[model samples]
Target: MLSRTIIRSPGRTFSTSTAMLNRCIIYTQNGDPAQVIRAITYPKLPSPPPNTVNLKFLLSPINPADVNTIEGVYPSKPSPTSNIAASGLGSQDKPVFVGGNEGLAQVVEVGEGVKGLKKDDWVVMDRPQLGTWSTSRNVPFHGVIKLPATGLTEAHGATMTVNPTTAYNMLDGFVKLQEGDWVIQNGANSAVGQLVIQIAKNRGLSTINFVRSRDDMGPLVDHLKSLGATKILTYDDLNDKSLRGKIKEWTGGKDIRLALNCVGGEPTTAISKLLGQDAHLVSYGAMSKKPLSLPTSLHIFKNLTSHGFWQTNWSKTHSRTQKEELIAKLADMMKENKIRAPEHTIVNISAQESDEEATAKIRDVFAKLAEGKFGKKVLLKLEDTAT
Candidate 1:
């Protein structure tokens, strides 16, 4: 096996002789992100393992799942890395966990046995929980998927694996939907939910999108309509008996075959009731922090099915070819202006920013996220081309 070296220090890329210190957000234990997450620096890496490739972070989105993982409440957890010792990075005794699950990066160096990849190629993690919130790191190449630099924006590619894939799979995986078919989902304004609305519209399928009721839901409604949503309803509307009559009238007797549930509780019950018969409901998240409560009569009389989906686990059984095909199709749609990245606010954690500056900026972003201050997704741009 063989390898190469490329070092990225703050403000500039450096030669092998001068190692770059790596800045990362890490947590040793689970708790509120503000109290638990810390910023640390690791010395420049040594040569990569034969099958490993060095990646310079391009952009990473701060997903809710990532925060839940840090809070020790997520199903997927970041594996601990022993490479960073107490002697390096931090003053603590044992190694800690790096944060973030999804991101896009550039291949800076490849070990000898690595094939079909080279310096300067863009890639995204094929799997999750391998940290991507840092400036650079060496990772096993099989866990990453390559991307053409021109097709998709850094934000689109960076956020692809989780929310987009979840949307694509939820639409395709559960049922054999035909043109004019209807699907319903709560949390329909979420990134995945918006993608579902667009993809369904693209394929001649219609969606009944449900979001939480607010004083004024005009913006989200107008936005989803632009993305081709067939029907948008509030939680309060879902609770009303007349809503079903309206949905039926809109669909013109077309069957509602699938219900996507991310927010549980009554919203889940409401959508479940809309399914005609033998329809499937896929649950991916519980942003409302409530248990899914479905009436037993639906299962007995209507023959409804309830399932949970996790994109990270699905990747393990799929082929690289299959994954790339979906990515390319979505990117092509984006290129044609048929679909777009979710609304997002960029949080800069540039390599040039000092430790104090970087940490403060990161903390501020998390604070906003914790406060639910941003209606759009928050993306972390750390490298030159990330914007």
Candidate 2:
């Protein structure tokens, strides 16, 4: 069972207070990873707009995009808000802005005009701008998706926003794949890739997954296969021409209709070469940080389609109803054991913690991630009571 706790502001220890308090992580100037994040405490919350709900965050996953935002490369920028109340020495001014894009929250209070949600409802919002890294948020009710209560833990709910949604949208959006249709993707062991394999299996699609050689490839391959991957290959196999023949045989010589590339460069080119004519290749990330180069023959003769996908763009253009439908489907799949949450390591950024401690912890994690040493997703568990 998962441990649960209510977080309150440190000031609560000094006196009996009724005001809602929130603690947030912010970055003002972007440069090195260490200089970016600072922990700020707020004494009170701003009055919610009409038809809005105030939410207490339960969990927020720290994603690569969050790191990119701190480095000032990401497109979305946090805007200043006066909603945060005064804290101690820096209490008079609102904090720069809290830093997370995706999280799972519970509605603790609703504005008078808000209708669809009430206290104690599980919800998620696209308040990436307001920041999900904080202990609480005030967002329009329409922006929130109410999740089913039973069998879902706060960690699963919090981590649901990015990876799972990205996986679902990528698989469902680009192709018209049918049962037994073969799809190929790199980064098979990644959180998104794992979800893709599970979703594909649920839809009866076949998958050809690729991963880098690692000490735990056995466990990773077993995990993907358990999720219904048809075959698993490593980057080393892409260099061997014979593997292409093996892929062809496994795919029954049927054209691989979709190729999902998270790692670019030669690996991407290899996947492109394997695609049958009129196949689609979608690039959602560049983990390798190398530019993708494709030969002219594949483009000219194969009639292949190459697309770049950003989940942020998809979220903006898609309707709430459509997004909710996808979430509902995923939740049902979880209930039926068709999908499972990705493995993750949790870092609790409790409101009462010291800034140095939080900063040091985050910095170390970022370093590990940059070094490719961290294997699972890192999540920040926020607390909200008086905090």
Clashing pairs in 1: 2-112
Summed over model 1, clashes come to: 1
Instruction: State how far residue 79 of model 1 sits from its true place (Å).
Output: 1.3
Q: What digit string (tens of lDDT, one per residue) describes model 2 on residues 215-305?
A: 7777877777888888998888888969878988888889998999899988899888989989899999999999999888887998888
Candidate 1 residues 1-387, lDDT tens each?
223366663333433323356667778889988777766666666777899998878788999888899899887877887665434643345558888899988787898799889877778887778887877778998878887656567777788788878999999998999888988999988889999999999999988888888887888789999999988988888657787788789988877989999998877987898898889999998888899999999999999999999888788778889998877777777766677887888887665666667767777778878998988898876532111
Query: What pairs collide in candidate 2?
Result: 21-387, 87-91
lDDT of each: 0.81, 0.78
For model 2 the TM-score comes to 0.89
The 10-residue segment of model 1 with minimum total lDDT is 10-19
Cα lDDT for residue 141, model 2? 89
